[model samples]
Target chain A: MAEYVRLKPEPGRTVSDQLYQLGLEFPCGGCSACGGCRVRLVDGEIPITEGMREALREDELAAGWRLACQADAAVPVTLDIEQWSARILTDNTSVAFEPGEGFGAVMDLGTTTLVVELVDLATGDIRGVLAGLNPQGRHGSDVMSRIEFDLREPGVLCEHIRGALGAMLAEVAQGREVKEVLLCGNTAMHHLFCGESVEPLSHVPFSSPALGARTFAGSELGWKAEVVTFLPCVGGFVGSDLLAGLVACGMAESAEVMALMDLGTNGEIALGGRDGILCASTAAGPAFEGGRIRMGMRAGDGAIDRVEATEADAMRCHVLGGGEARGICGSGLVDAAAVGLALGMIAVSGRLNNAPLRLDGAVQLSQADIRELQLAKGAIAAGLEILRRQLPVEPDVVRTIHLAGAFGNYVRVESARRIGLLPSWKAPVAPVGNSAVRGARLLLLNPSRREAMIEAALRRTRHVDLGGDAEFQEAFIENMRFMPPGR
Target chain B: MADLETLRQAIIDGDAKTAGAVAREAVAAEMDALTVIQQYMVPAMDEVGRRYECEEFFVPELLLSARAMKAALEPIRPLLAASGAKPAGKVVIGTVKGDLHDIGKNLVASLLEGGGFEVIDLGADVSPQKFIDAVQSTGANIVALSALLTVTMPSIKMTIEALKAAGVRDKVKVMVGGAPLTQQFADQVGADAYSENATAAVTAARRLVAAG
Candidate 1:
């Protein structure tokens, strides 16, 4: 074949027309939401097309960055680039929490969402609770996208996240006299709060500078609280959230093997036993938070709480807050996937059955929806499989499967196991709603708990890069089959 | 004598074996290979590309057609080579530093290669110096950079600056793609092209080569 350099015809073909002809599949329909089209200039100065100038920054333009899907190869050019992956931390040291008399607050700053709780330091009672989407989500749905924005424009990220937390705290406090504050978040979040650069967090052999927890004055974060403590990060991907969950669930108390999973935007899993604890985090992406999916939404009012499909192609849904269905939440999605598989509305490979589901409104799960659910479930299951492979005994040896997080609280445990999202074992599954918040609250209530949490964090060993595990990929493919292995 | 109509129909049917046999017969009858390609194979591939763009055909279909086109072109390789027909352009592609994901990058490479670009893939977690070296060694006119993480985007800018420092900034066009990059960010990083997907990358590369 004549290696014809498919060049843009000057004064003849537009970049868009050429791209369309090239058969490019643009996810997001080029809505400019995801930055999947970024490209760079390598040879001979090519003028920044209007779209390039609009999508990128001046520094980026000066640095030869462009969106490959948007940029026209009409001009002479050479481009070098690759795909980026999310990084997780594994090592963490114990932190000390000193509780004082008076009202205090605990916060869990998650990638997709943020939650805050007001606590009475003397009694450990939660006064009020508030949850909302991370304001920085407007930049990108996931941590990687947010980090990308931060890299392009310095300082904006820290300010944006801090502002969001400040607003959330103000709402959750609601006239309470908040004296101290305790924060639990992933390593990237901690770094952003401390005004530390996240450059290292995204590189190979990812490491977080803050291994143990640290106490800072509330004034440091422009707050009036007397004390502010940032919980120590466990590892790059495994953050205080998992540690806090472990503490709240009392995973270290019993000698029996226990598996603790904090399922959110990032799925962090830690399996503990008499020998030691092994943990890993998976970039489950933002499917839980409804980022990439077509009809996904957060666990909020008006979101679908449950779904069931019947043999007659009939679909039923339960809405949260007894209102019209806005979208499907994470819990509802899990249920729908399991139920759909059970009812034969979806095939094992996550393909929607040829028979279309009929619902009251526009609440049917499409083929794409099933695929997205499969991906999310695959990642979680794969993480568990990786932990099992590293364990000495069989998965059944694990005594308990503690499900942490708000979404975990509502998920159907049986459905989760039915879909192979969790290990098929006789171990008890307990739902600890917002364990990170609870652990943070405990730290605020009892100063002694900080030492225990810190010890647990330090004693834990983190498993790196679930993506590299061949077992994870295998599990992902198998789990994507939606149906039971024997079936 | 067989006209372009009959040959075009054969190409459209994806009859690579028959197309090759016909092309060989035509050449033996003193017909031009370029005429056969421009009049038949390219048009057929264009149809396949169109079907792909319309979603009527998926990756498997596209791959099949591309294979067919390759098979048909095999018999005319000597004629094109003897004519010293140069590729439309050359590109070096890789994932940015700190990133090991390559599914998207691999897809883009496949589409670009199918589009007839001489692509030198650098795989994943490629450093700025590696990109420069690839560009220098391959004499590629375009550099396609992919990053799936926001944390590694700084490396993209650094690579661009490295190319400039090597005093070869004006010698090639740089393109960037991934889940976090935007056209605006691409411009800020000084990239010449920003495609949203693999198919678009091929289109963009072709345009860049043609513009040159």
Candidate 2:
């Protein structure tokens, strides 16, 4: 899950300072904890500090392993960045759209990742794709952290993300004229990118006044597109990404009630049909995406992406690129937890019988890791339950569930059900990859559908604030147990 | 005596139904309700706290034990109050303004209650004025503030400033605790003390009340 990069460190700046622009992640916020920002001295010397001694083992230090946040290279050096070549989900489903004039671009600006795709506006064809870790990650990993970061240093994240995304847009529109550009992200990203205040979002009853659609001339954002627009957000934590997901899945225009869930750090859920749409956001921490767990990383080279209980007593794992497993990602974590539950290695109470169930080389599920997943999956499960009760029809009327986002798309439905992460609904579950970008692509191709769909989404959607809900507490605690679905 | 012992074990095991049943049996038998809570339930919660501190239990286990202790205390509450048993102390508690997270705050409140404190829980997103008002009205000597987010950590200081503004700063001991909190932060915010976790919060509250 690492790649080498040559850098000439500034005399005073640390290694994190010089390489942060390269989307290098410091999962522990570069506090020299977690040892996640480790870099090997490929060609030059990195002086080992006390932090390296504490975080790295004896053999690891002897092999030139150093914490990037602690050590700096005096001269030009090639150091291997541990979190590189991330597998961002850009494979979107096809949609019919009205032909437009020329080329266009669509971007799904996530809190952790950025994806930009160039599209042939007249033919509905994807020309090129560019994806990277959102550089704002260096500030903080989640939305709440980003808000806190922005509160301290106002508008820095905004300017940083805008600059990063503008570069992506420019690269996506290389020389060829892009008629217009469409972008969609969660409410935090939407607000940060549009230069709106995150003050209201940082408090109780978290909703913002500036969630409406924002438009700017492409040149104004240092890009060459004719028009650039970031989509509007639904109320509360339900961001425009879920709105775009609704559009992509055609939920609001459907006959039967369906559910769309984007299981990111902020797990957003929407339930409705042609009648109406109900959305609520649950603070599902980054457990699903391998945040906070020891030996956790993004789905990249050498990350364990899948796991299975081959027999009752044995476990097996599949790494991403067929090498030694450096870390485990969300999908693999779900599978491991499910497998643990099946084998009775992990109790329903999230206790590890043999504490720290080793999955692959250096990757193990600790007791704390199980608790984190419980908290995360509990939030999502409870959110779904709360939204289901509010539906006009029967509680079990949801016919299908459209699992959006990379985690949802890549996660195994059977494993999710086994751990009660997903309910045992009598319906088909479909993982529509990158629905936000696909919805944005739809809007880019057919501008005529934009105003009406946005209006409908705004008018018909009811945001349920889980914080204020009375039943939410009980539901969340109950869902925290890793029971079989429907039990 | 056997019922009280069963209640104690049930609380430690996080068996709410068993704890509640034992508590009801003790109440029906007219056992001293205050003695049941002061000696058994409190000690049971302390054992749960010890287990949590040593990593033998996690948050779920702590919360489960809290819930069970709450169940055991339910039927004993009225009897203890009717007998005119004074609580250890009155404490006002809430998550600070701009922070909606209340799980950790609720845990502290539950543990405080189990420790025989008359907890006036104001819930999350509580403003500074609310704390001052609770202190003035309830005559509570301790105010506990919780903030989960780093952005809302300043609210703890602001709440303290409001207490000072209202001229009740000296009258009440302010305690702060959360995930991102530290002793340095408590000192910076002019708090009387800072506890790292819910169990320590009980000890801190007891010390703060005992100091006066």
Candidate 3:
């Protein structure tokens, strides 16, 4: 167990402000939407705020659980705030990266996050890692918003991403000879960073204008790397990131039918094996990223990233960066939905039992929140069904579900199954940790790996367009319910 | 004789099998097909439409009720044709260029059929010229255009302008719809009418058809 610290609240500000001013890590960014920072009252009782009422269950509210963002400690209430821990997906399970001359790096350009990792070229050792929230988030949370911005003004996002990478490069390089950098992102990010016009991607049938690999010198980004090579996009919204994931998992050559699902703001599903692969991407929206939820945020310090319910219906939580609960982040939202289902608080139609699922009368899941989850999960479930139907493989025959992306890596499989986020199946889940980044790293370390990915993108895989499929439309409406469509 | 009350109740309950069987029985029993429709089937859909307008009935509920009504109407279709029963109106509908989504378009078509109109669904990804050709061929009184994407919504105005250029603008009523379309946008596009949802589309179609 981590040590709990007792701290006095500064005059009148909420507990969240006190922590923020203290320069402590609170992932909620002090947004009331994510009760990410919560400090429990160990001594005197503090009246719960309205926002807190929705986040905490009945027992939690009674037991002195209070939102650090919502509850202001007028009198220094002895607070029990646990220290933080981050469950980052740092496991490099892909074919080990062998070293080279001086050094190299791999970057995962996520819509919401930017992660840069510096590696020792000779020994294949990860020297240092830097992660920063994607600076382009000021425009919007999802890729679609970024696309709109691109349409309004060309080359704006390209500058933003290029500059951000440049800053990151400066920090990691430290005047060392960083020979090459491998980058992988979704179709939109891939286009923006490479200075490609996003005219084609802004509309439907998202055809990438310049999907081929491109190399940019360090001078281009005003950084230290000699060259940065972007991975090629496969098709449609299925970009180089997915190709990277496919490379990391080594999915193309397997004899047995397998599936890879990357759960994120957009859900990309692939079903294939020795037979040609079929991939599709659905706009699952930013529900998993804390977008469009009453109480949602990215997984950060003080965020409720895991949740459980007792036989007596009391709610318990596992917060990321384990301190007092700040707010429910993406992983926590999935857990709450699962736990809510278990307690019969969320109905099959995704309707809440009555009001929101109240955790200590401080945290609640509103009816609208359940609907948003339904729409988001429904799109993914439908997309998967479409891919399976187009292919010869049955769900039972697909022996493994390779869950990719940071959301897929950290999310509990049982929770995913409970919410129908992942298909209801008995197949073993292989948590391929941030397969895109891993794939990028693999490509950076080895030339054969790069060749394999390019071959798969050009020859072995077919991108299935489900936009107008009747079966997919029917499945989408049916999957909108909490229950599986077939049932 | 088959009971009209049973026919109406089947439609309201969304039971297609029961609705079809009862409708077939009524037609075989020498009941006037138009009489059965005016008295029971139409009234049943009217109730569903009312509930839908009031938000008591949602999309799924509205769809189920429409399906049941169609089941009953299918048995009466040939009989009404023999009797020279006129459709309430003729409508041609399609989602505009670059917008392949069909949910809203399909809903409006089903609701139009429930409202006693003939709808020729052009499916999705339809162009302005295609809409013009359809209007010229079908001699439709109303043209329903849908576009879900803000970028694609301009196609609706193009279709309307195409009608004017073809000198058939006065012949048909233009109804523009989709999620991104607002009344102001619809008016700016020179559409005769705008609807927020499929249920409202039914009402707007009826108003346009009646005005003529």
Docking class of 3: acceptable
Of the candidates shown, which would achieve the greatest TM-score relative to the real structure? 2
Q: Write model 1 residue lDDT over B94-195, tens digit each, in one string.
A: 988887767568667755654556679998889989998888888999999998776777789999999999988889998899977899999999999998
Query: In model 2, where do residues sit more than 4 Å from their true spots?
Result: A1-96, A392-395, B82-84
Write candidate 2's Cα lDDT for A1-487 as tens digits: 1235666768777766765554454544465767867778888877888878999999999887888777776777777543332221224232346787788888889888898878887767665567788999999888888988888898899889889988887776678988788888988899899888999988877879888899999888888888899988998867888888887777777778988888988888999988988999898988888899888888776778778878557789888656788999898899999988888888877888887798887788888788888888999999998888777557467888888776775788999998878888877888776778777776777678678877776788889998867688778888888875458
Each prediction's TM-score against the native? 0.67, 0.84, 0.80
Listed for each candidate, the true contacts retained, as a fraction, are 0.40, 0.42, 0.23
lDDT per residue for candidate 2 within B81-137, as digits (tens), equals 899999999999999998878888999999999888999999988988889989999
Candidate 3 chain A, which ten residues in sequence have the lowest lDDT sum?
Answer: A83-92
For model 1, give the interface RMSD. Answer: 4.7
lDDT order of candidates, top first: 2, 3, 1
Evaluate every candidate with DockQ and list the scores: 0.18, 0.34, 0.35
Between candidates 1 and 2, name the one with more favorable TM-score.
2
Model 3, span A287-323: residue lDDT tens:
8877788877777766777788877787787766546
